[model samples]
Target: MSDRTPNPPSSQSRRLYQMTRGALIILPLSIAVVPWGILAGSLAVEAGLFDFQAQAVSALVFAGSVQLVGMGLIKAGATLSTLLLTTLFLTSRHLLYSATMRTRISHLPLHQRLLLGFLLTDELFAVSSHQTRKEFDFWYAFGAGFSFYLVWQLASLSGIVLGQSIPDLDQYGLDFAVAATFIAIVLPSVKKLSVLVTVIIALLLSVLFSVQGIEGGIILSSLIAMTIGYAISIVRKEPL
Candidate 1:
């Protein structure tokens, strides 16, 4: 036998490394999300919701925009049917995320696929879909997703508990954190002119929607932009 020794890390060392790296990576990312959670929590309190109820919604629904819209509707005294319809419209983007992910994650068992689908939020999808390692596995994605979910719920709960004690966030420019994080995550994926055009169109539409007082501006803008982008691709005979 050859005299070479294996260089594998010990189990304890690997666990420590994963935990440390996960914390380091996740903490900053979690900070970026804190503002949105704070806004959600503040709004929940303003809507006459209890802390527990707000926390429950954050934990269960787990979609930021949808949660915000739902809270808004509740505050407006919207009927159940209106609330349900608004939520469906707001969350319809998940269908696209699910369809795209199915091709990548289809080899997994039914239960695993179902669980993954439930955990698939915008941030989780952004991180997991772009993983390039040959050894990357569903467990890694799951770990990231679970960690994010926990952090988000905790942040929202803290915000609810500490609502108003937090100073004027708008004056402090906290809202930019989410957009900055999104840009950081998405910039790497723009490999073609078509993709660039799609992003630009989406941003423009988002601005226009905001100007026009459209509710759920980002979602509406993204849907319109994606549709237009696909149409442009078809006209130009470009592959998606």
Candidate 2:
């Protein structure tokens, strides 16, 4: 064995420590996310999945909205091709996320960036992107991602285990949890009037589409709203 002593945390380690601390700070913010997980579990069970299978989706996929969409498609007897297409449309926003994050974590190795990309959810990205501290590093992202991942999985499992007992989610307003979580994630990102306007427009479009009984109403609304938002931002020359 080599006789070299292990060095204390270097600059990279210090940065990781800051990132971890940041993760700790934001972990509790995920309380708003639990209900969505619960809904996913319930939907999974309702779609003929066993509790373990439902729980596995939570632990593996961990995207609440996508889970719901997938379940709906499964219920409709969608083919694998259709399901993959739908999932791609729903998750296309990650392409934008990857582009933006490239600048933020550029100093990290490619493998680390890839790992972080897997954990990049709306909530974690929203919080971490605003971090200006140089010390904030991969650990911070990891902490946030890992915590959210674990809690989401557990909450989903709980829902799966108890979905049979809980017959009326609408009565409990649990279905709204997904919306609430999205709102919570979004509110912090609004820093200007342009952003606020975009959000309002998105909401209006979403409501209109939902009222019209559009399939994939939320996704449709998001795309319309984002398109409108992008147009307004471009017209105004707003710096994103």
Candidate 3:
């Protein structure tokens, strides 16, 4: 053997490596969320939401789909109770997501845990979940989540600022970008036969519902498809 001493990595180098890896993992995925944020901000303004209300919706509310639906209901003159019920319905899935991650993050301080809850978007959760190595790295999760949070908030704010200038944003069909982004996210995960079947069923249901203009049908289809997938797994005696 050679007489050279092999030094382990420095603490600074390891921390930097983790942070960089975590941020890189989520940054690309966050591009999918940018259009939704812009659309939410611009639509809020066009829907006659006051500046402060829009801020509350984007900053405090933080759930993109829920906020969009809530803003639309508000614009349509829906009652406060109606908006509350609808938003709750739209975001009910978050309860399940939070519960799933509870054990993993239980060691974090209370404040950091609260922050994680706030930043736990679908994309963030997906990325962080796949990061098996960083499960216990609070700073790594923070780096990924905080970077995504900044992009979303800044994009929404920018859209709000530019909404007044571009009164005809709908004419550009920006919603298509958000739809395409979701498709891109889903397509990569269509590997297993069960997952493939579930996706096909969900797509068919979504198309039918969209053609019928059935409000909330997409969400309903998701629930139904997931249940079907679970039943399939049981029939195969496979764990989900």
Model 2 over residues 1-240: C-alpha lDDT tens digits? Answer: 232336655656755776677566556556666767777888899889887788888877778778989988887889999999988877877676666677777778888776677778876776676655453467778777777787788878878977855444456564465466557767887886677877897788878878898766655666677777787888989886
Q: Candidate 1's error at 151, in angstroms?
A: 1.7
**Residue 48 accuracy (lDDT) in model 3:** 97
Better model by lDDT: candidate 2 vs candidate 3 = 3
Candidate 3 per-residue lDDT, tens place, 86-128, comes to: 8888787777667767777777899989888898877667656
Residue 215 lDDT in model 2? 60
TM-score of candidate 1 to 2 decimals: 0.76
TM-score against native, each model: 0.76, 0.70, 0.74
Select the stronger candidate by TM-score from 2 and 3.
3
Error of 2 at 42 (Å): 3.4
Clash pairs detected, candidate 1 = none
| lDDT against the true structure, each candidate | 0.74, 0.74, 0.74
Q: Model 1, 192: alpha-carbon shift in Å?
A: 2.2
Best by TM-score: 1
| TM-score result, candidate 2 | 0.70
Full ranking by TM-score: 1, 3, 2
